[model samples]
Target: MPTLRQQLFRIKPVPRQKEDVETDLKRTIGLFSLTMVGVGSTIGTGIFFILSESVPVAGPAVIWSFVIAGAVAGLAVICYAELAGSVPVSGSSYSYAYATLGELPAMGVAACLLLEYGVAGAAVAVGWSQYVNQLLFNLFGFQIPHALAYAPEEGGIVNLPAILLLAMCCFLLVRGTGESIVVNAIMVCLKIGVLIFFICVGVTGWDSNNFADFAPFGISGVVAGSGLIFFSYVGMDAVATAGDETKNPKKTMPRALIAALIIVTSVYVLVAVAALSAQPWEKFDGQTAGLSAILENIVGSQWPGTVVAAGAVISIFSVTLVSIYGQSRILFTMAGDGMMPKLFREVNPRTLTPVKGTIVVSAVIAVLAGFIPLNFLAEMTSIGTLVAFVVVSLAVIILRVREPNLERGFKVPFYPVLPVVSIIGCFWIISSLQIITIVVFIIWTAFILGLYFIFGRKSSVLGKQLAEAGPTNPESARTDSTGGAK
Candidate 1:
């Protein structure tokens, strides 16, 4: 068996030929663009839809839940920035784990991310369907049947709009129509614009009495709500993933991560305050399209509600595209590293995108969107993301002690203290999740680990090279460890 130290540092970084990798993404994505991607990918659905679910748990104190979740996510992103800057790779936490932990561990991380990005896309699509229906109802007094708009658990047959949205995203990705930074920026602005409009109008209808029993369920409720709301902060790590594409990553990456976190947290808090102040927390339960509902309440006319619903539909579509893109890229990186099937590693000769992998992932997400209930999908995403964040927090400490000499452009401030705190925070939040979620997560991890040992371990490039080279071919073994040819 290989020692953990050897596994962690064994990979000698491979220098990719510029021609082999897609140059389209190589152009520097500046801090502003990167920050917008983070905000755009994150600020949808959760605010518009999840408030109904969370308010019942935390009451008006759901605002504190947002604050707690954002703080933990911010800390985790700091650690992610250090790892991303040091590795400068595309696989996000999976790639970081490969360089800092080992092959098997990296495979496990990739499995978890499949849950995080792919299923989250499905969940967001479901939310998009609700807003789309709301828009139609407000505009023309026509609505899709509830059976087509929701899942069976919610007393509906299928989520047709969610499936359609996922399919549309799939077609765009397959055609290599990648989302440009400009488009992402525009979407972010639109989402924020509508949200601000709702907040301003909604505040005018504020009822101070609604906050009287703020912490209705007490501290436990606040913690549970934090776990539920943590899904809103999921995309903040997009900043860390852009390390390879940033101009002057050392300076820009950290600044962008912190800035994005602060902006997203502030927006979430403002929206939460606006919503809670406008009505009693109990009224939020089962309210589809919460923001749109607030708009309707404020204006006493359907026009403003229609506008907010339209904004939500458009922005959530973009969020699905961004998320599915991220998921495909992570899988492509893993395949390139020889952890997955070679088919996933194939990049389109014409578009320079991972066409094969993107299609495969899109198909899976489409099926999930068609069947899975939105609430279950959201909780599952939260569980996977929280686990991955915990792994990242731990990896920072492991790499620091194991490599010590590795070049890192960005470092997490406060060293050991920050990472420890991040780990504790992650654990606290994840613990508040339902027992079923914990059980499902454990089973998923075990299944992935089994697959890794059976297939990934034996066929892994590093393992094969180690078997063939004995002790003399150190460079070959290192190249294999890095997931490329020597």
Candidate 2:
């Protein structure tokens, strides 16, 4: 038997088979559909409501926060592209770390991914609830009561609309990925137009005075704000998580990742700039339906607010759907590796999707959305995503050194320097997060590692395969196209 340390340090083999032909997941996602997954998952949560959370911390300098967060996310996704090309599997950075770093590190990445996708889904659902209320009030002149629409911490009994939104997303995800992607694509286009409408009308109210106190909180505040706003960029990596379901993923994944990044970042900065110019940064705090409220303030009418709120209602549904989809798929990958329960990996024959896992993921996310405060959820998501991005950047370097001839369809520009910067940038933002958030993250990761020692390490399919092949030639056991033991 191999030593405990050796088992922990074992890396998964880089897949060399045809991704399209050898996977259980249907390869129906093209570049456009995949890019929409990223966009649909991202745009809904942040630009629509994050200003209320971030602008308070960085003041009008939240503009810089958006740019900083996007820049770091850009670098990380570039490295992610290379790894997705090399590993060509589901599970995003978790699988990348397994292929390059080791089993233990992969588990750590899994903990981070759970937070990145699952928590983010809940966080966005909470934002969707706020917009739902706005839409209801706009059109019907009534809204869900505070006790049912806001979290307990936010002075409400529970967030009903958020839970309802998550339930709707769960139903769609259980149906199929292809169907979900098409619906998400249509929503993406509509929301983009709605955001553009907000921008055009918002510019009309630009006072220029909002710039006078841009950096009220200085560098520390900017960094902290980036941490909160980083939650907005979480969905970009959902592209990589779809590797198993993407057609020609090697070429398609990178293109989709980059395209999604460009579109999301551009829309984010424009929305931030337009939002700040229209109102003083201080007014953003406590604004539940942020964009719609801002537009109503600027136009002095209900129609513009109603329009934006309606668009947000439509668009955020797609965000919740994609977030649940990504979370369930990551768990599916983990279960296939024997790192999680078997139910997560079981696919329904009729739907061709992991129905059980999707339902479970939705249940957990519903509880989170219904109870947790959005700011706390958002920060936790940012911290988790930052750690995952750091791992992906490091994995890029490790893979380059370990498998110099690996067949990668995409490569990071500037090589080691870019990935190194990505690592540093991610850590920088992580450092600025609230101490409590950091403490919670450490506790969560340790808990996951504990589970590994008690369960995953013993039941790992890779460990069994390695034992069968003998420690002297562990590489011979090999993993399948799905990153499970072959």
lDDT of each: 0.77, 0.88
Model 1, 376-482: lDDT tens per residue? Answer: 88778877777788889998998899778777768899999999999999888887778998898888888977877666665667766665667776555655212
lDDT of 2 by residue, 1-486 (tens): 689898898877888875553677777899899999889887876677789999999999998999998999999999988887777788999999888889999999999989888888898899888888877877888989999999999999999999988888888888998898999999999999999999999999999998898899999999888878887787788888898899888888888888999999999999999999999999999987788888888888889988988898888898889889999999999988889989998999988899999999999999999999988887777778888999999999988998898888899998889999999998887777789999999999999989999989998888888888896876778988564565
**Lowest-sum lDDT 10-residue window in model 2:** 17-26
lDDT of 2 at 318: 88
Question: Each model's TM-score?
Answer: 0.89, 0.94
All models, RMSD in angstroms: 3.4, 2.1
Best by TM-score: 2
Residue 315, candidate 1: C-alpha displacement in angstroms:
2.8
